[model samples]
Target: MRPFTYEVPSSIQEATSRGGADAAFIAGGTTIVDLMKLEVMNPSRLVDVNPLPMLGIQMREDGLRIGALEKMSDVAEHPEVVANYPVISEALLQSASAQIRNMASIGGNLLQRTRCGYFRDVFTPCNKREPGTGCSAIDGENRMHAILGTSSSCIATHPSDLAVALVALDASIYIQNGAEERVMNLDDFYLVPGETPDHENQLRPGELITAVRVPRLLWARRSTYLKIRDRESYEFALTSAALALDLNGDTIRDVRIAVGGVGTKPWNLPEVRQALAGKPLKPETFAAAAKLAVNGANPLRHNGFKVDLVQRTIVRALMNLGGLA
Candidate 1:
């Protein structure tokens, strides 16, 4: 790891003043330390944000506002979260392990790096790490590459179950930079890996995530996160679905769907939601909606099976949500 200066600011303004292009906020240091050890990330300074007072989960009239410094385990185990938002709890429980969940912060989870093998190896060309350097996964092993929202410049998948669940819940992020505060929809927070794959988020220099707000939903209580991986536990998803359904006498009143593990971002299926709106929750209806989920999938050579697998996963998720399986 490179030698770097460390700073702990007492206030957000002080932190922003200390942060720069070469500085990064250290929350849990799980993901950051790993990347630093791999030489994928080299920062000249580390700003410890844990000392700040922005570290609480509160239930507001509008929704649940989770502080960026809140630990993953605390958020997952919060009574309001587990009782009202099962998808969020399940997504957190299924990610990493108990130890990691204990140490990883909600903000760090949102900013975690991709699990792409090529991106981890500094010697390999990764467009996400080094712009215009070429993507090694394009011609190399790409079984876990993205099928949706993939550009020629990059095919790396976003590897955050919590982010996928949050997207499905239509969450928003609150950002602060020296008293200038702004809110952004979670869907728009992450950028597509087009020409500038190195730029993953919409956050600017010296900006810090303050909190994430998830609006209250009637269907949120009935939601679930279904993850399918090669192994059962402590593994990334091959294809996963975070779904919430509002049912009115077996008819789908409203549906929220976000897919993970097969897309460059948390793939929200608006078309599928449109197809299922006001439709009866039946097997055939789910099958048809599932078919529409992967409508424009651009699978790579080794990941063509993901197209079919994702469709099946969506169908199964729908079935599970409707209790029709």
Candidate 2:
């Protein structure tokens, strides 16, 4: 590992001021530390923001506002979160392990890096790590690569179950740079890997994420997060679905759906949501809606199964949430 200077800022102003091109704001250090050890990320300075007094979980009238430094375990165990937003709590609980969940923060979870093998291996060519270097996953060992929002330049999938649930729930992110603050919808948080795969998120340099705000929805109480991986626990997803539906009697009043492990980013399936809206919650309807989920999917050589797996996962998720599965 490369030698680096570490700074623990007591204030957000100091943290923002200290962050630059060669510096990164560290919270939890679950993802950043691994990359640093692998020589994939060589930041000259690590700005620790855990001491900035920004760690807490608050329930507001609008919805829930989770602090950037709040641990995943805390958020998962929060009574309000577990009861009101079971999808969010379940997603967090299903990720990593107990030790990692206890150590990883919500902000750091949102900023977790892709699980692409080539990117993790510093010796291999990975466009996400270094632009114009090419993507090895494109034609080499791409079983876990993305099927949706994939481009010729890259095929890496975003590896965050929490982010997927947040996207389905219409979450917002709060970013602060010095005294200036900005908020953006979680749907716009991630960018597709096009010509420039190195740029992953919409966050600007020195901008620190203060909190994540999830809007209250009627279906939040009846939502579910279904992840299917190679193993039962402590593994990355093969295909996952985060679904929330508002059912009026037997008909769907509203629907929000986001998919993970099969897309370049947390994918919101508006087409599927639209198809299910105003329709009866039935197996056939779910099958039809699931079909829409994989529309325009361009699967890679080794990841063709994801196209079908994602559809089935979506169907199962909808059925489970509707008490039909």
Candidate 3:
């Protein structure tokens, strides 16, 4: 890692005062350290936010409130989280490894960078790493890259499993810039990789995420997170789905769907949810809804498989959650 000065700010105001283009907020140092070692990121100063009162996991009457600094392992294994939000628990347990989960914070996981090979290698031209430089993955080995919400500037798949589950639950992120605080839906917090691929999220300079709130939903209790990858464990998802269903008898009353590892962001499928809303929970209905997932998919040479894989993953997730399979 590059030589850098570190500061542990006692307050959010002090941290935001030092945060800018040259400084980075470090919590778990999981993502930042990896990029620093690869020489992909070089921040002059590191502002530690671990002591800034951002560590708590509470269940309120409204919903589940997860502090940004809460460790991934703690959240995943929390009794309340596992009982109420199986999708969230499963997503966390399925991410990275036990050692990483023990160290990574919830906020850090949500803001983790893409795992694209080109993006991690400083020598390669990755638009996400250096905008306008070029996206080598577009024409290179891009089997793990994105197909949905992809722009010509970048096709890197979003790497967060927690983000996918939270977006499906319609979670809201609380952010603080100095003393000013704001909340935004998790779905809107991540910007699509448009012309500016380097701009991955909606977090402004000097802003720090405080907590993520997931509203209570009847479907949330029946949710499931299903991932398909090259290996069984300790692997990133090639195509994954976070599915929640509220069923009335054999019919679907409501549903929420979000996908990861196949899009520039956590891809939500409202159309599919709408298509299956009042339908009977059956294999045919699941397949029909799944087909709508790839409505605007722009698959590349080596990643055309994602278009089909995304649909299959969604169907399987729904089946797994609904006990239809």
lDDT of candidate 1 over 59-172, digit per residue (tens): 889989999999999999999999889999999999999999999999999999999999999999889998888999988999988898899999999999999999999999
Error (Å) of candidate 3 at residue 263 is: 0.4
lDDT of each: 0.91, 0.91, 0.92
Off by over 4 Å in 3: none
Which ranges of candidate 2 are over 4 A from the true structure?
Answer: none
All models, RMSD in angstroms: 0.9, 0.8, 0.8
| Candidate with better lDDT, 1 vs 3 | 3
Ranking 2 against 3 by lDDT, winner:
3
Cα error of candidate 2 at position 125, Å:
1.0
Clashing pairs in 3: none
Residue 68 error, candidate 3, Å: 0.5
lDDT score for candidate 2 against the true structure: 0.91
For model 3, the local distance difference test gives 0.92
